[model samples]
Target: MSSEEAAPLLCAGIATFNALKKSGAEAGDMVVVQGIGGLGHLALQYARKMGFRVVAVGRGADIAEDALRLGAHVYIDSNKEDAVARLQSLGGARAIVTMISDIEAIAALMGALAPQGRLVLLGAGKNPLPVSAGYLVRGERSILGSITGTPFENERALDFSVLAGVRPRLETVPLERAAEAVARMKSGQATFRMVLTMTEKSHARP
Candidate 1:
């Protein structure tokens, strides 16, 4: 993979990986990753390498095969199947590393947690994630949020990425086309990641 492809490891990858590490997810734990974009892909790989049984949740079947290839033991296509029910059938997730800002989506998956399971939020959203007091009390479940961590954790994410051969699939564009890339990303048109590469010509442009 190119440097452009590896750029997200500095941000998205580290955030998700750190969330998983802090989620109390042990070997043989059932871990679910919500979303299959930049962060979720790496999350799936990291979860698998860390010895957890990985389940990848995405909106559709578009990412199912890739999620499986990335080491997800199960793929939950939220559009076709009920994510909560599917996870429940597997005895619920020990930890869910959610990478989406969709509050409803987050709310929908909270019930899929096992007792003492946590929902770790790596993506920020303007809306609040509402949880019932009874819900938390009943299962002893909790929600935690993680941003990119200290330099050491960042370095660890990179080192682990290298060691585990976890990599992001990328779509590279010249720096001059950053706006186009951003639009594509915002539109959810990027099949995976969009990376911007710097060049002398792009640097020289006003």
Candidate 2:
């Protein structure tokens, strides 16, 4: 997608960038990123640019190389290795930013946080995250939900996107094929963000 295509960035891009900026994780701090799709992809780049040591976690080995290419210092396949244990071995993560809606996935990563570390939830989900009281009290860890950012934050996200070359990988389809694009996303077949283009028909219509 072109630089002018800012729709996806306004939503997913700023959401992840703002979460990382507010996470209190500094340069060289280990930050765990959950999921490898839309938001997670952008989060990896932003976290790296923010100077955090990024560990990208996903379901399978399929995305391992892709995550690394996206600036992850390490890639963890949750299906193969215990994500919490893996993070613990690395001295725990300063923050875990999740872009997937799976409650259990979120709960699993909560245990992998360093003391006082934060778990930022950016994905929408209906299920409850089952975190124990002792986990929160012992480490002073926290769980937070993030929505889209303000106009200023959005502008910052855009500026960073240009400065850091943090562009979203997108698949563009004609406006008439919007439904097909949605289906691709729903089926987990879309490797990146999907954008719909305005056709000549669109301009000619009301």
Candidate 3:
């Protein structure tokens, strides 16, 4: 793309990604990202960049550091304490990105929202989730699923990516080590992302 086109792409994308902060995040609003890995890290930075007070929630010392580095105003160590109470004391986040699919965790996270808040589900579930109906119906809340962006939206996301200087923190393994990489990701040892690469002579092994 030409230099002229580049600015438009990035600006539009950044503007669009910033849209996520709307409805829930005003200048003083609190936002929570439920998992500080991969997309959760991006959500943290996006929440911050859009002027929300961000609470990064997850279960590891390593993740706390990463979330902080990604611009979370605070980090919740889910394993060490009651995440719902902690977030509630923070004035209760008005929006959450439900990156972990644990039913109880999602329910708690949903309850952690302020009235009229939103929870956007960003992860694929390991099992069927048992989300509580009361939280949504009584809290006047919304739960949404976000897939990849529209073509235009995709460009916008990449643009926000550029503006936030956000890139997936990735670990690379050779194509032959693909299975191991998946295992690492499943084990939560992969810091953010696990990527597989192919050599010039590698076969199309799908």
Estimate candidate 3's alpha-carbon lDDT, on a 0 to 1 scale. Answer: 0.67
Worst 10 residues of 3 by lDDT: 197-206
The residue-level lDDT of candidate 2 at 171 comes to 74
Quick one: ranking by lDDT, best first? 1, 2, 3
Q: Report the C-alpha lDDT of model 1 over 1-206, residue by residue, as the tens digit.
A: 44764688888888888899999999999999998887887888899999999999999887889899988999999999999999999999999999999999999999999999999998789998889989998899988999888889888988888898888766777888889889988998775677788852322110
Tell me how far the alpha carbon of residue 191 in candidate 2 is from the true structure, in angstroms, after superposition: 2.5
In model 1, the runs with Cα more than 4 Å from the true position are: 200-206
Arranged by TM-score, best first: 2, 1, 3
Best by TM-score: 2
Clash counts for the predictions, in order: 0, 0, 1
TM-score of 2: 0.93
User: Per-residue CA lDDT of candidate 3, range 65-164, in tens?
Assistant: 7788888989889889888899898788788776676766776667688888887776667766666688678878887765444567666666666776
**Mind sharing the TM-score for model 1?**
0.91
Q: What do the candidate models score in CA lDDT, each in turn?
A: 0.87, 0.86, 0.67
If scored against the real structure, what TM-score would every candidate get?
0.91, 0.93, 0.76
Rate residue 46 of model 3 by lDDT.
Answer: 71
